[model samples]
Target chain A: MIVSGSGLVEALRAGRFVVTAELGPPRGADTDVVRKKGRALRGWVDAVNITDNQGGFVRLSSLAGSLVLLDEGVDPVMQLTARDRNRIALQSDLVSAAALGVRNVLLLSGDHPSYGDHPDAKPVFDLDSTQMVWTARNLRDHGQLLSGRSLDPPPDLHIGAVENPFAPPVGFRARRLAKKVRAGAEYVQTQLVFDVGAFAGWMAEVRDLGLHERAHIIAGIGPIVSPQALEHMRTKVPGVHVPDAVATRLLRAGTEGFTEEALRVCAESIHRIRAIEGVSGIHLMAFGREHLIPEIVDRSGLDRSRFDMNACGSRERSADAG
Target chain B: MPPPRAVPTRPALSSRTLYRLHRLLEPNGLYRFVARVVERHAWLRRPFTRTEESVKRKVFGCRMCGQCALPVTGYACPMTCPKQLRNGPCGGVLPDGGCEVYPGERCVWLIAVERAEAGGHAGDLERLHRPIDQRQWGESSWINYWQGRDDGLWTEPGGRATPVDLGLPVLVTGKGDRER
Candidate 1:
């Protein structure tokens, strides 16, 4: 039988500290980068998340990118945002992800269209993130769509949603996560985490509400490559909170010392964030710094696991699996 | 927290003017005080309630989710948006301010931002709004405000229902295809 779900799910289920990485597809039609990243990340991460036009910029569809990674023997967590697609398209894509052998799905109320490449293009937020989670739950556990229509075989999908731990009202973030879980999120990938203390507090609340029991909370970590990059994320991203110390360090790095501090920041975040009670894993959304994964892994000093042939993917299990 | 059922506010204050009043009263204790008075009032509530409902629905496309965020949103009403966006505009808003859902019309969030900018309450627009309470539908929001229907109240009510209880079930009334 095929080992279902995704590698990330397996690691979480096993109570292992999970590591997942993001793979953003290029704007053009090319699977080379996707496959390349897949191989580079194969043993390093439990799963790879393909962003759907991240930051409202146009790129290859996550579904197509996921297929490329799937072909390359990488577990791709296809992200479906409500910003561009409506319920029909979203549900259809969810079904297609299973058909295409993609097991993990991350649902988001995508950023507004105005933020993206085609500001002239219309948005289609048919459902918010909460409702999308509910819709997915109805389809998964109930084996029926929100309309009560039955499916021949419910897709073996592992549903996930995004949470901004530091988003205010800070207290409501946990409640939103609870709602997402109740609506059927098996895991949560949060906004970039720089404030570890705030995350620990959020995790405490998640544990208090027993949300951590139901959903695996994976914290998002990223390396600020440049001071400009740091500035953009801090001001433009709605819920992300970038700390001043990181900013000051990055500014002091002054481009020459950039790499060392950036690497340290990413690694230290993983180390500190891993200690949080409810954090089941770390999601490295090293947005533009995919090449730095090796440095991140080295600095974190965390246990690493090689790819399991038994895990779902096209790659056959063998002695040389890693 | 339903009121006496026969009392709704009859302030002779029109909702158009009332929206402006809310903006003014929000900082002071007056908004809550007015809400309490409206909740406790007794008599001729039906006509007043009906007028209030129709006017708000027509002018603002109010879903009346029991939490009125109009004051913070520059009175543009996030609830007026098709997605009922409480936080901010989704990335789907067109450059010309057209609705991604309705199309050919202005995005409520776009209008809200313009209002916020003009009113210099842009920070208020960025403030997070907890999910709306659907159970308060059809009830006078004025009364709900007094009862603290949503978290925007002076003090957040303790022990509210979890998101599991809050993320209501889909009605599936066949509008599923339209949202696409």
Candidate 2:
């Protein structure tokens, strides 16, 4: 039986063109920052993903940030990485998140600490991303831990895993997703995609495997916001593939009109991505610029009406606020 | 001997001998006897592990993970990956098939994938490898494998391994575990 634990899963299962966005928790112990970002993302997206120390920099815990989002009536997809925690801690966090009402989890192997602030920190990749997915599924379906111990009441979660079509061994990326699916990933959120042609080609292979029928494929898209950010993501960000054409266009746009041009590119990309066969949704990652998502979503010409907001718990919270 | 003189006996024997050797190495059948001998002598553990380390480190760049995955990973040591990814390549493989952490080097899993596909053992790549047993680090995996000590690391034919098979104690007990 499918555990429709989160509205994100429900929306996807109902064939709604879902829109999800990322929220980076602040580096300090500031709940207000999370709440503000959560509020900005509230109606614009179906769910907000609380990053788990994204980029390996120390920040507020993803669990705390997710709880803040939950308090603000924004559904949170709590990302759990295997880099920091072992299987025990991960399972503990999973059950804890469930107890606190966070139902969506996007499992990742996480960025190496060498790329983050604390390069000296010890990495505990006790489990890889696929193993983490299998752990979560084991908890949900079998009501057992990886050790096979029975949980009196298992933490019900919607399993999501990240895929990067732009990465090397491109031919094997689709098959990797197949492995994730077999491991029990119900949905897949891809890494930042700047080259639609490459993505479409990858999607063709995914179609050949009929993976789209088994899992919801959400393409990752984001506004560059600045030429510096564009370059950083293009060159510095691991697994993020930004083609030379994007860099050239952003360079031509210059600083004065870069944000507009970047958003225009993003909106246009969304239009193209929407038309791509088998893409169930778009995961907007507007790094540090949550306010622009509404404008980007509006400009993308995607029908927002398909998202039934009343079906979610956030509607009740908004009503209370009113 | 007279009948064998009619044919080129050396080529036929060489091919059959090579095939038998290959079959023997597949399960490390001969190594099991060596492992048992090493197991009986407690003093040989460190030396055996060090020897294994020197040989594998030179060839496969092995990290002495103790739960060796080389057979399934096209003989490429997955421990060499910056992240030590066992199941497959992480999403961070560079555009040119470079490692994410060390872009100059090719991603180990990518090499594993290509080699496995080439060797027609591509399905072996799909087998989900569990997390490494940290206790087994720097130990002799050959002896561990022969003794069935690392059975938990390898996926069972039925899919996931049970805790009993993994040799994990029932750590989560009644009231205290649920108290949280």
Alpha carbon lDDT of each predicted model: 0.68, 0.77
Worst 10-residue lDDT window, candidate 1 chain A: A313-322
Candidate 1 residues B1-180, lDDT tens each?
A: 322111111223333565576755443367566556665664634454566777766656665555677766667766666556665554344434455545576766666665665666655643434435445656676655545544442112122212222222322232122110
lDDT of 1 by residue, A1-322 (tens): 2234336666677677777888889888777888788778776777889999986899989999988887867778999987788667888999989877888999988776666778777666656776677667666655676555677698888889888776544544576566567556889988888888888888998999888888888889888888777887775665567778778878888887886888888888888887677778888877767877756876787655344554345453222111
Which segments of model 1 are wrong by more than 4 Å? Answer: A1-6, A308-322, B1-54, B57-83, B86-180
Which stretches in model 2 have alpha-carbon errors above 4 Å?
Answer: A1-6, A306-322, B1-22, B28-31, B148-152, B155-180
lDDT tens per residue, model 2, B1-180: 010101000111222343344456544667777888887887887688789878766566666778888767767667878787888888888888888777788888887777777767777776777767677677788788776655556563225323222214323323211100
lDDT of 2 at A20: 94
Q: By DockQ, who's the top model here? A: 2
Supply candidate 1's per-residue lDDT for B15. 36
Backbone clashes under 3 angstroms, per model: 8, 0
DockQ of 2: 0.28
Give per-model TM-scores.
0.68, 0.87
In candidate 2 chain A, where is summed lDDT lowest over 10 consecutive residues? Answer: A313-322
